[model samples]
Target chain A: MTRARLGLGLLGLTAAALAAGCQDVGGTVALGVRDEAVYAREVHAVLEARCGTLDCHGDARRPLRIYAETGLRLRDELRGQPLTAEELGDNLRAIEAIDPGAAAEDHLLVRKPLAVAAGGQRHLGGELWATRTAAAPTCLVAFLGGRDDAAMADACAAARAEVSLPPP
Target chain B: MSRRTLAQVATLALAALLAAGCLGETPEEQAARALGPDTCGGGRRRGEDDDEGGPEHRCGQPCLFCHSASYNPGEKIFIMAGTVFTRPGDTVGVGGAEVALEDAAGHQVSVLTNSTGNFMLSRGSSLQQRGKGQVRVPFDLVYPVSVVVRKDGVERKMRSHIQREASCAVCHAAALSATSAGHVVLEGP
Candidate 1:
């Protein structure tokens, strides 16, 4: 009986070890994992959802088109090369500050305001900004999550303000 | 076990521990460490009022606009131009596009695409170069033009392939688009 109990205990330990090994460390926070390929995807999604829409950055009518597919086609129309550490850091800081705890940063909530205040044209819509404050952490958080929402009211408002658009 | 065997087991255990440590922390942890923790408490608060102007103008609204460009002191300004083609009568707005210029060192200068499918960056500016003017720049810079177009209520985004002036010349050498004024056209399908 003693030997059997010891064997059983050893088996349990092995099982526990195996389970621990199978557990995922990256889980949800995996979004923050900054692989070049993954970074490309994350940045692309964030730019598209937050920056690309309406006549802001989304409108082909605008100059300096920054669209979803910008990552693949960055060699043609712009000078220099891919994003640098500093630029990415700047973008991340802008987005992260507004919607802390989100996987991706919402540039609309934070960056847009700073840009507009600094005399930069607003690339986001006005509606987005108006509703942004109300939506609270979710809108900001979602932006940081790099998730796309069909109705980005807050972002729209903030963007509109950045461009000095009239109130709706 | 013998002394040699004991030492070998210890070494093996140390190697395993090292491997486990490496596998323990993920890229996100590293990025968070690099970026720092979030102290903002993951909630929205209203403080400042965002008052810019009246409602945003729709497509075809005439307005004066400026393209973003950088003027680095020690580099020539490489202007990238492109075109966005649309239906003859359809009024579509261009905005929320990603524009970028990258150097060989992965240093990128970027600006959002505006409502006219135009983005520009003036590298080697006097301000960037501490009041230096006209410096020799390399052609190694890559210019990327991309934009999102919104018609009615739907949004469509497009990005051009990474091609330099030299590469573009391989096809449109004779009818090459002008670099001045950052003119690049996007023809819709």
Candidate 2:
């Protein structure tokens, strides 16, 4: 009986440790997904289509401009460059125009086209991401955690939990 | 060494372990502490308001992302400091011009200029400089900041689309030429 109790205690300790390891309370988790790669695959095209306009990000006069001539070329260029190289630096800066630390707060993901109820802000250029839930995946919601922090954090937490498990 | 005794001990140990792992300051509280005081960027503390029934003087912690001189891959801090003037080409400061910055999230705060026309949108606390012209204040730089100045029934808004530049004097400098207006001026007298 004493031995069985000790074994159970050990199992509980392991579970507690695993739980603590999985929680990304302070954004400590690695999130397993590289935001830059995700930006390349899911985000870059949308930004080019919506924001890279004649007077907006594509324009040099504007503080926030996306100068890429073509979406296909832009993706190829940004993704191909080594991290240290200064290629597509301005585009990256536009992506992080708002808080880079919190995706939900990033202006690129939520500002313009998105409605007030969906956490979008007013932009002189006009709205980009219009709805939170549409027939197809609104690229903005997928990137900005689908509406708020709880959803985004859950995704991060899930990624971390999966990564924490020992490989079979 | 009964089965009941083993089960009770295991249950108590598990509960204790769970309690130890789960109890502590919330994430928001930890973010507040990590960023520093709630002066310009976080939630307002109890009794932070003045006796005259003024607005709470707290700001969000995210301002460090842009305004902080010291930054890393992790976090930052800022000194909510700026200046206000009578108008373009005027040397004298505009006392009592209400200077306010509204973020995209709709969080806003305002402060009055001193006799020098300098307004560091802070509470009574003096700003501590981190770099040249940089001070510590509760400012989150994530949302776009809109700088507005209202005085003598006249208001002036920034022509630039976004308030990315926190240091007002950097762009709205003292005039060096005829075409260049050294200071930010109110549209009306």
lDDT of each: 0.36, 0.47
Q: What is the lDDT of residue A33 in candidate 2?
A: 27
* A1-168: candidate 1 lDDT, tens digit per residue: 699999999999999999999998764423232333433333344454445332344333443344332221223443224445443443444334433454333333443423444432364332233333433323443544555554454553443333231111
- Top candidate (TM-score): 2
Chain A only: list TM-scores of all candidates.
Answer: 0.26, 0.46
Stretches of model 2 off by over 4 angstroms after superposition: A1-168, B1-68, B71-78, B122-141, B176-182
The 10-residue segment of model 1 chain B with minimum total lDDT is B59-68
* Residue-by-residue lDDT tens digits, candidate 2, B24-126: 7565545435643333311224343431211212221233233345442323333454456565555445567787777666766666665545555332254
* Best candidate, lDDT: 2
| Residue A13 in candidate 1, Cα distance off native in Å | 3.1
**Model 1: number of backbone collisions:** 97
DockQ, every prediction: 0.03, 0.03
